[model samples]
Target chain A: MATVEFVEATRVYPGADRPAVDAFELQIADGEFLVLVGPSGCGKSTALRMIAGLEPVDAGRIRIGERDVTDLPPKNRDIAMVFQNYALYPHLSVAGNLGFALKAAGVAKEERTRRIRATAALLDLEPYLDRKPRMLSGGQRQRVAMGRAIVREPQVFLMDEPLSNLDAKLRVSTRTQIASLQRRLGVTTAYVTHDQVEAMTMGDRVAVLREGQLCQVDTPLALYERPETVFVAGFIGSPAMNLIEAPLEDGCARFGETVIPLSRAAARAAADEGATAVTVGFRPEALELRGDGEGFAITVDLVEELGADAYLYGTAVAPAVSGRIDATPTVTVVARLAPKGVPRRGEKVRLRIRDDAFHVFSTKTGRRLPD
Target chain B: MTATPPTRCASLPVSGRRSRRRGHAATGWLYASPTALFVLLLFVLPLFLVLRMSGSDWPLLAGNQGINVPDNFHEAVSHRFFRDSVVFTVKYTVLTTVILLALSLGLAVLVQESTRWKGLLRTSFLVPSALGLASASLLFYVLYSPLAGPFADLMRSWGFTFLGTPEGALWSTIFLIVWRYAGFYMLLMLVGLQSIPDEVYEAARIDGASRWQTFVGITLPLLRPTLTLTTVLCVTGSLLAFDQFYILTKGGPDNSTITIVQLIYNVAFQGQNDLGVAAALSVITLLALVIINIAQIRAFSRRADD
Candidate 1:
């Protein structure tokens, strides 16, 4: 087990205008499960590959444990990787696949067999040990891939969206299995995925990336509650955080005629940026359904029901409810509500964001406002 | 990602589905009738005629006289060049198959490299295959000539002639064949190599496999199907070796390079002028080819299963 570090690592593909992963820097503590999450082409996988030494560190250094291994090959990095496609040797049986790294290291026959068998048992793959990879189902193939990495018992584990190939139900179950397995093995692991929920649930610390740059890295809850940028606030949540452009008043942010009181620090931050408007944000669950004509009114456009809870997606008229005589546009918004009393489509519902739940950011910059 | 579930096949009554399948079979036969007729007229009819000729007293000019049966088989087996030709053909087939497969595999790997020279290397290596075998053999005939060949000076310096002896004759023919067909076999190998996903190699690299280990463990095994195909083609082509030998040596150098097909050609049209013996020799060669191909496929697949 080793701590993996990336110090200002960058990768630029040939003929490309920009670096695919630009100045990426992070340190994964020993035994820590760090997830690199982003949208497609966001350089999350490039960052993980850099640590595994699969990709060259063009501009900076990477260390595994105490070794500076920027120029080392993947095999010498003491890392095991589980590819998204599984990448199992289609010709080899499960046992052979599991023992490949051990055999490569010239492990004795008896010890190789023992390690393979143990890994098979751990992955519930003993029954399939004699079967080639194609003979197994997708979930089984995924387990064999994991077993191949586990049998190596390397200093670090690198997984690039390993569960992406599985069906939805299997992905959920295997997600927990991988988290628990990494904890049990106490191996430093860097997992890359575009699934925000997977990153939130499985990572010891989640590093959010966008357009080849780190936006934020924090514990899941901390990232959810205190996202450092407007991007993180919008990206980290399911159904996403509702961020609306609102004109700043004396000390408040406005939504329609609903005046949201902001912290003094937030107003000061907006003033410091010399911005006339602030982006007020709130999570879907932070919205409270008030009585008619009590708060900001939104016309319910759609409702997504999920057993116990439901989400109301609607469009609320933007600004100028105070009769400025200028034209106003409608901004789409989302709010989580109880399934039992969920309003139907086209119903106008008054909603209020909790006083402490508002996330304020300056309009001139995408950075989050203080407090 | 929420992928759509696979659509279930529509169910039909067993008898109805069976009738539908029968209708499909009839349509398939309808579509295949032209090709079937072509094969019958071209291959099957000629095969049956050969068999008939082999079992009868058929002379090249006089046509069939009477049933000869075992007499033709006996004469074919007892021909003076029969034993020597069979032995030489087998030797050539074995040598050609091994060398062609190994050299083509090496070429395929070289051409498959991601270097900037890949296109140039591939095109240059494959250029010789564009030449016809007979034409290539004739080309090599001039190249092997002591008076007119480019290698005349080099051969003089080395004090060795290309087609002056039995061993030289055999190796010169082999060289001509390799130059002509090496690129074709490498193309087959390259197709097989490209089918292997790149991720598998990355996985092997992370497994700490050395270059030699990866080739032995991953590449060779996965390329087994292509190897079997190329081996069968090389062996069969070499066993039917006629054009190059005929054009170059004419089974000379004490007839040390006589091949089965050349012997059959001699019996049918040149010296013996007996269609029965030629037909018998052809049947034997065809049977041997079938047996060898079956044995080769079985051996490779059995190892794959293990």
Candidate 2:
């Protein structure tokens, strides 16, 4: 187990105008599995590489278990990494590939063989030891790569989208296998992926990055329930959290002529923070389709019905501010309903908002309003 | 003598010509005929001529005689010059092959590891390859001029004549050969290096492999195919070396630097102009090359299979 501390680590590629990873200050607890996730070009992979010492950290220090390893090479840091491509040595047999690192480290031949066999059996690769990487299937090759890393038994593990190359079905299975493996090993791991689902499901704490900056760092439930910023709120959930811009008046938020009663604490916090407009976000599941009133008049544009639940995609056409002050055309909301009673396209529906489920953020700053 | 020209020949439609598959086949053959003709005339015909000449003892100018078996095989086997040239060629081939492989592999590693100024170094390595061997020999001859040359003073300072003796000339040629051909091998090796994905190196690094260990275990093994190819080329080229020795040494002091090709040239064109013996030697050289290539191919394929 290792405590990885990135004390204001920054990575700037030479001659680039902006840093690829800006002062990323993070502390990963011993035995903690932290998943760094974001959209493409968000610098999550860069941060992981920096931690692995594959990429140099231009400014700041990195420590692994009380040892400052900022300037140390990957081998010196005693860390193991599994790459996206699996990166198994094509020429080496499965056994050879697994034992190569140990052999390189001058471990005895007998011990190397024993550890290789143990790791291979752990990965269910015992039958394939004598076979070369070319003879192995993709999934088997990935297991061998994992086996190679596991044999090292290093202080930390770094995995960069290791399952991204697998098929969808295989990805799901491998995801569970890798999470269970990490848990059993109890090694501090920094996993990098663009897939939010993998991050949410696997990470003890998911660190969301946006443009080289940490947007939010929390458990999946906390990040989903109490996103601290607009980016996080919009980024974390599937089908995305529907956000609408509306003016905030005394003790309430106004959408067209409809005035919804907000919590007194939230209004006071917004007022105290000098917020003029508010962005309201609600999950699709939290919204219920109703029949009448000036609630939220939405014409169903598209209806997607899964087996258990269905979603109604519609645009809210209300005369809201439609300028640079608030450019979005009213609002587009996705409502979740049971499969048996899903809405049809072109059907006008009124959405009954769950007030407690609604998340309010300041228009100017996009910071979450505490209730 | 025409039996009768068909009147339909004139009436044959242009559309009929367009539809004819024979015309397409004729066009395809027309494009291929030049290369086919050249190969037949230069390669196939020369091969037949060599085979015939190898079995004969046709002296220079025929000498009012017919072609017959000349006991050239006995002469080739017994002659001291033949033995010397064969030994010298084998030595040169083995020495050059090993030296070039080692140097080129090092250069390949350097080129692969380098970041800045790599283009400049690569171009410098390739510059010598562009020069013809004969021209390069002449250049070395000038550089080796004892009266007034850069190498002369340097050799003097180092207490050695770099081209004054057979050993000196052999080493000078080896140096020239390495300088000229290492870059070509480096290019091949660089392609091999770049083809190995960065992920592989990262994986090795994370697996507790030191840079040296990775180079030996991973890099070397992966580069074997390219290394094998370059080794074959180097060995074959060294075996067939002639122009530089002919220009720079002309068999040197005591005929010590004469390659088999140089000996063949001397037999056919110098003194007696013994074409029969030269042809026989050429046949032997061809057989040697074939045998060497077969051995190398077997080794290469066997490793690949393993």
- DockQ of each candidate relative to the true complex: 0.73, 0.66
Give the least accurate 10-residue stretch of model 1 chain B, judged by summed lDDT.
B1-10
Every candidate's lDDT: 0.91, 0.85
| True A-B contacts kept by model 1 | 0.90
- TM-scores of chain A across candidates: 0.96, 0.95
CAPRI docking class of candidate 2 = medium
Instruction: Give candidate 2's whole-model lDDT.
Output: 0.85
Model 1 lDDT tens row, B21-106: 99999999999999999999999999999999889899999999999778999999999899999999999998888998999999
lDDT for each residue of candidate 1 in A1-371, tens digit (9 for 90 to 100): 88988888899878988898999778999999999999999999988888777787779888899999999999899999999999999999999999888998999999999999999999999999999998999999999999999998899999999999998999999999999999999999999999999999999999999999999999999999998889999999999999888888898887865788778898887787777778888999999899865669999999999998899999998874342365767889999988888889989888988768878887668888878
Across residues B45-162, which tens digit of lDDT does each residue of candidate 2 receive? 9998887776777677763144566577667667679888999999999999999888888887897779797888889988888998888888887887776777778777777776
Which candidate gets the maximum lDDT versus the true structure?
A: 1
Which digits, one per residue and each the tens of the lDDT, describe model 2 over residues A7-41? Answer: 98999988987888999889999999999989998
